[model samples]
Target: MTRLVVVGAGITGLAAAFEWRRRRPDDEIVVVEAGDRIGGKLDRIRLAGTWYDTGPEALLGRVPEAVGLVEALGWGDRLVAPATTQASVVLPEGRFPLPAGTVLGVPASADGLDGVLTPTGVARVRAEVELPPLSLPDGDVAVGGLLRERLGDEVVDRLVEPLLGGVYAGRADELSLAATMPALAAQVRGAGSVLEAAAAARDAGSRSRFDADGPVFVTVDAGIGALPAALVEAARAEVRLRTPAHGLRRTAGGFEVSVGTAAAPEVLTADAVILTAPATKAARLLGEVAPRAVDPLRGIPYASMAVVAIAFPVQDVPAGSGLLVPPVTGRLVKGVTVSSAKWPHLAGGEALLVRSSVGRFGDESQLQRSDEELAADVVADVAELLGLSRPEPLETRVARWGGGLPQYLVGHPERVAAARAAVGEVPGLAVAGAAYEGVGVPACIRDAHRAVDALA
Candidate 1:
């Protein structure tokens, strides 16, 4: 029997093992996780009689990989779409509804941006249509710089920064446009004017998935944690929790992995190995095995963050889904999700759950605070943003994710390719995780499938 070992029991690792088991039932499969739990960032907790995902709460259902996995796991019936998708941005004065028909805060013509942008900012975006033709950068360019030249600094600061922050926990000024927003870069390169390009692209998108009024995101009643739980259950693999892989060595037949403490270590041998650990740990584990890929793997930076879930009476909750705060505002909290409003299931009648995200690239000091301090700061920020009195929450829970989300910097694709090439040199070995590709659940699943297939 062919023996395969998968490290790090996160969604990516679970998906890899599950797919491999489905394709080869006769093979031996073992999954090892350093954490006590299976899910990595897909964590869920119960407080005040309701379930809340302290980590990633929903999956972009538009991706087939996510929806397909849900259906395949027989959890399709449990899937619930957001009741409200409307969100706002927190400004100096207060909250302003995000204007529609914009792709990642890049408006088509700045027509409906009265509350979101200042008069001068609106005029600057409108001027993009008449602005001179600009040549695109050859390889990679910062998203902020590109938009600032085409649109203006005010628009990029006020609009694009918060939107990109919500997704990448990164500022557009430092983020790579080609890696983060390829379509926008391509459109800007082809069209003479940025505004015209945005309009044309929006028009085309209106005829595609972007215009679909259906649910763009989906979650289950048990929370997104249910996804990894189900995948781990379905995978025909022997799971070892709290058992970290310390080292790996290549043998004549395949590979040998050292597990547990160095004092009394246990080594397991396998014909093939799939490492789904985070970038830092994966690099360390492969230091002795694949030195060539170490630099590229270590080059990928990770952003640390914390989530504060506060439960309040439904009466105190807002109507919209959530609100994103721009870094320029200098708020302790970056964003707040009206969990009760976004996922009706989370409401469950009695209490309204609201979760606030804190910290981003170069702003990780906030994450170092104690849970009590972090929660207090988040509550204060929430009250100020919503213009409500600071009322005591019924219950509060804090989840800290250090080095959670990976940063996809400029030339990230090339770096990932180099890492893969180095790993390919070692037979029957592969790496898969959010560090290499997209950070979404769907993307992790897709990456896992590719890793498993590579060995086959």
Candidate 2:
């Protein structure tokens, strides 16, 4: 019998374990986690007799791997799509409708920039057509830098910043285009204009196999937290919670993983090991066997953020999925998701739920405040955005996720490849998580599957 040890019991680790058992049932699998509970970031919080997700609430349904895993887990029927794709952006006056035909708030056409862009800003966008063929650098560039060159600073600040920030929890100017938005990056490579390239790409995608009209995202009606819970339950592997992996070393036969204190440490030898923890944790564990991988892993930075879920009467909640706050707005709250309007399952109750997300890459000071302080600040932003005066909520809850999202800096793709090569030098070792390929649920699942295959 073969022994497989999967470190870190997050979705990625659990998914890898589950896949291993499904394919090789005879193999003994053990999942070790430092935390008492599983689901690293996917947590379910029950408030006012209803369930809400503290981490990611939805999955990119367009990703086949994500959908396939959910259906395979018998959650196909319970899958729910966003009731509406419509979203708005917060401005000085109030919330304004996000323009159509925009990719991550980069408008493909200048027609919808009325309320969002100033007269001078609109002129800068209109000049894109007349502007000479854009010259892009040979390699990866910051998303904001590229867009600002074409669309002007105002558009990048008012539109592109928030949309991209909402996804990676990092400023657009600092995020790498190749790692964050490859499609747009490709378009920007040789295109004469950014808007023209975006328009062409959108048109091509609409006419391709991609379902442009399909639901962009989906989630389990109960909550996304259920997915990981079901995964852990179904995997039925030997799960050791509150037991962290302390050390790793190569052995003649395989590898030895150390846990607990050095004085009375327990070591488990395995033919294969899959590390699915964050970059920092994974780096520390690889110190003995794959020392070279540690530097690159440590180079990867993480951003912390907090989510405040508040419930109110249906009438008090704003319409639409939610509104994103452009950095130019000078707002503390980054974004807000009107849960009730987005999902019917979250509606029909006496109270409607709204979630406010705050804190980002370089702006984590807000997280230093107490939960009450954070919740109060977010509530004030919500009230002001919705034009409600001192509107009290029926209930409120705050969930803090320190080091939640990973920042994919420039040269990320090359860095990831080099890290993989360094770890691959050590036989029967692999790493998986959102830090590598993607941050969404589907990306994590797909990454896990690849890690499992690597062990084979």
Q: Each model's TM-score, in the order given? A: 0.95, 0.95
Candidate 2 minimal-lDDT segment of 10 residues: 205-214
Error of 1 at 271 (Å): 1.7
Give lDDT: candidate 1, residue 95.
Answer: 75
Which ranges of candidate 1 are over 4 A from the true structure?
Answer: 196-213
lDDT values, one for every candidate: 0.84, 0.85
lDDT of 1: 0.84
Lowest-sum lDDT 10-residue window in model 1 = 205-214
Best candidate according to TM-score = 2
Error of 1 at 298 (Å): 1.1
Q: Which residue ranges in model 2 land beyond 4 Å of their true spot?
A: 204-213, 261-264, 316-318
